[model samples]
Target: MRPLFVIVALSFAPAAYAQEISAVCKYEYTVHDQGQKSGTTGEFSLKATYMLPVGQPLNVQVRTTKAPCYEFLANGDDMQISGTCSRAAQNMKMVYVYKIDRMSGAFEEHFSINDKTGIVHYGHCLPAKPLL
Candidate 1:
């Protein structure tokens, strides 16, 4: 009986160390435009909330916004952006393509920008990107 008890306890111990749900992540990004030859920068922030369950894919929602510019909503595997500050030649709004992988934390975030377009993009995804 003692040996059987030890085996059961050890098996459950590993499960107890798993990541938890209700994880919140935040990320900030800055974009610089070198083409203008004027050195201008744009900034944005992103927040992600999600749950992590063993043997289940992480579920998450990503929200990003650039003050006086645009806001975006990304849920699960879908990404969408809307809102505009002005009606200029350039499209005030644009959609981004991305994917998420499981990592250590329940939630994860990153800041990045397109080198050629000088488009600053920042956001968080979950259940955090895989470390490997």
Candidate 2:
């Protein structure tokens, strides 16, 4: 079975202020086969909320937090956040990466640890868009 520690469910409050960021996005995807063509595949359905202060660096030393965020100039929907979350005190450390681009309010979050060696695709479908 795949390690499930990567899954994090965060409970957040509604926008504390207009610039106080908070959003809940639901994604459904299949468990990716990490280049092992002989293994059986499974699926994952999860709901996660992305939160932070608009245009501010997120530093949550407790569990996990976003570093900072920037979006595509051509369109504001595309974004990426780099961060790190520590577990079991200082014993465990993991760097988290989040990337997503949504045309509308709908969004799909793709997460990977350290690198892209293993990737899972959620409902990341968007209409064909030309690159700038």
Candidate 3:
């Protein structure tokens, strides 16, 4: 009886511990591939939310190395993102709706343009560290 009880308790612990950590952040990211003969370069300003094992929903503004790269803002179900695509020589902006899943801890994030509808999909992006 004791062993069975221990197993059940342990199983539920992980779900219980999945608390949320929230913070407002700002970061700069650079994407460049030298091997490619022709590559695109730009930056983005994004407001994001993630599930962290600490407090609330993490919100952030991310920018690119280039000026006017991109910008994103979110308020509940509403999200607005804008930026310039220098390689294509096109200025683009978008506003959309997003559902928030508030949880806790560092989770892997995948980035896409216009809900994964575009010529290219920017894959894995790491969280930026603050400078000293």
- Predicted candidate 1 versus true structure: per-residue lDDT over 85-125, tens digit per residue: 22223534332433332232212222223323434334333
lDDT of 2 by residue, 1-132 (tens): 122211211112222222112333334553453633222233222222234343444521111122222221111112432233222325433333343332232333334444444444344322222121
Candidate 2 structure, TM-score to reference: 0.31
| Cα deviation of 102, candidate 2, in Å | 5.8
Candidate numbers sorted by TM-score from highest down: 2, 1, 3
* lDDT of candidate 2 at residue 72, scale 0 to 100: 14
Q: Each model's C-alpha lDDT?
A: 0.32, 0.30, 0.28
Q: Give the per-residue lDDT digits (tens) of candidate 3, residues 1-132.
A: 676445433422232122211222222232323322234343322333322322223232323332333433322211221222322224433322222222211111223344443232232222233221
Q: Whose lDDT is higher: candidate 1's or candidate 2's? A: 1
* Model 1: how far residue 131 lies from native, Å: 26
- Candidate 2 C-alpha error for residue 28, in Å: 1.6
TM-scores, one per candidate: 0.26, 0.31, 0.24
